[model samples]
Target: MIPSAFDYAAPATVAEALSVLADAGDDVKLLAGGQSLIPVMKLRLADPAMVVDLGRIGELSGVRDDGDALLIGAMTTHHQIATDPLIAEHVPLLAKAAATVADPQVRHRGTFGGALVHADPAGDMPAPVLAADAAFILAGPEGERRVAAADFFQGYFTTAVDDGEILTHIRVPKYTGWGAHYEKFTRVAQQWSIVAVAVMVRVEGGTIAEARIGLTNMASTPLRATAVEQALVGAALTREAIASASAHAAEGTDPASDLNGDAAYRRHLAEVLTKRAVIAAAGL
Candidate 1:
């Protein structure tokens, strides 16, 4: 199957890309790495009349440390994030997840922003981004606006990005004292996760001070396991406590049923994986 005929425009500047999108309106799609969009287009799931390619926009492709946060440009490739020394030291959770996304060939061409914007429930990036409490920088004709990771994803394959808006960068807070781990359960080496858990634990004096748990393929959007987080706070950083808290992973989630796993099966995997992730993150 081939994608429908469309007008292709590669803009050298962000302003030009935005102009193309604004003029093309809903009929236009922003092309970043095109790993996700191109497949959908070929399958005839998406039929945009125009594609505003951002590959030529040099400003949207770098990684930098911004004060207390790590700013990753939207166009940065997954392979770049996986191998970056700064990312490995500052946000190992992201680097770990990036390494598990698809295969090396896909990672070579896939963009972080493209994956996040695609908002697939099983995609690996969203869970870690949620656990990191990242923020997205969106640019449009009106200017730039910052959106939290929690609010940026509205539903499956849907985002809070309005028409004509382009996600330019992602700002992830530096979790200096936090121990992070990403545990993914997949059927094959390069397959999407059947269920994945991203855990970030702040341990103070052998006690759990703060915890954030994000679930992938457990709901319409990447869901924060708030119930589990609430249960872990102030608890002793031990395997028993982590197991007990992780039992609540499915307490508030509404996982979908699919070929990989049924809703109940996913709920079970969520609990099991979350426990393992939290224990590992807590060094238990």
Candidate 2:
């Protein structure tokens, strides 16, 4: 399949990109990594009249430390995020999750903000962001606004990014002393996860002081397992305690039935993976 003929614009600045988007109105699509939009265009699922390429925007590609949080440029490649020293030191859960996305080549080209804005419930990236309580920075003609990860995702393949807005950066809070893990379940290598769990645990004196759990492909959006988190607090770092807490993994989930597995199977995987992620994150 071929994408419909469309005009293209490559902008060197966020302002220029927003200007282009503004002029193009509702018929334009912004290209970041081209990992999601290009394929959809070729499949004829998306055929915007114009495509604005943000690749030339140098400001939208890097990692910077900002005291309590790290500012990750939207166009930063998964490969870069996966290997960035700052990310590994402050947000290892994201690095671990980014490393597991697709394969080496895809990781080299796919961007972190692109993945999150794509808003695929099954994507591996968003889970870590949710667990870390990250915020998305969106730029538009009206100026910039920060959207929390929990509020950014709206529904299946939907998000807070509007037609004229571009995601410029992701702000991840530093989880300095937390042990984290992203446990993904897939049928084969390079395949999307059927269900995945991201866990970050702060352990104090052999007890779980705080826990954050994020779920992938478990609902219409990347979801925080608040129930599981509440259950894990003050829990002993033992198999029984982990199991009991993980049982609440699917408390408010609405998983879809796909060829990879049915809804019930996904619920079961959620419990299993949540337990594994919690145990691993807690270093039990």
Candidate 3:
């Protein structure tokens, strides 16, 4: 398979990239890391008139500490995020999830921002971001604006990033002392998750003080398990309590039936994986 003929622009800076995108009109696509876009284009699923590549934009890569939060540039690869000292120290949930994305080669090439923007319901990255309550920073012809992770993904393969806008950075608050875990289910090595759960727990006085639970492949968008999260709060971090709370993991989900598994099976996986993730996160 080959992509349709399209004009290409490799911009060296964010401003230059924005200028290119603004002039290229609505049919233009921005390329970062090229993991998702290239495949879609080759399959003729997405054939844009122009592609503005952002790989050369140096400012759009790497991570930095910003006060109580960490600002990660959009172009940073999964391998970078998985291995970054700052991410591991401050946001272990993100680091743990990143390490599970595809295989090592894909991890080395896939950008964190690209994966988020691609917004695959089954993608391994979005759950952690949603759990962490991260903010996505988008740059466009007008200027820049921030969209919270909760509001970013609108539906399957859709996001809040509008025409001529590029996601430039992601801001994640630090959760240094919290217990976190990412539990993913896949049919084979390097396959996308059939179902996955991300959990972060803060325990105090032998009870769960706070909890954030995010689900993958359970809806049209990556979902925050608000029901499960609420149920775990103030509950004793015991096996019985965790099992009771985790039963609510699929309470509000709208999972799809596919070859991998039907909606009912996925819903079951959600509960089982949620129990495993929460218990591990609580270290009980």
- Judged by whole-model lDDT over C-alpha atoms, candidate 1 comes out at 0.91
Q: Give the per-residue lDDT of model 2 (tens digit) for 254-284.
A: 9999889999999999999999999999887
TM-scores for every predicted model: 0.97, 0.98, 0.99
Comparing 1 and 2 by TM-score, which wins? 2
Model 1, 119-174: lDDT tens digits are 99999999999989999999999999999998999998999999989999999988
**Higher lDDT: candidate 2 or 3?**
3
List residue ranges in candidate 2 displaced over 4 A.
Answer: none
lDDT of each: 0.91, 0.93, 0.95
lDDT score of residue 268 within candidate 1: 96
Best candidate, lDDT: 3
Q: Hey, what RMSD does candidate 2 come out at?
A: 0.8
TM-score of model 2 (CA atoms):
0.98
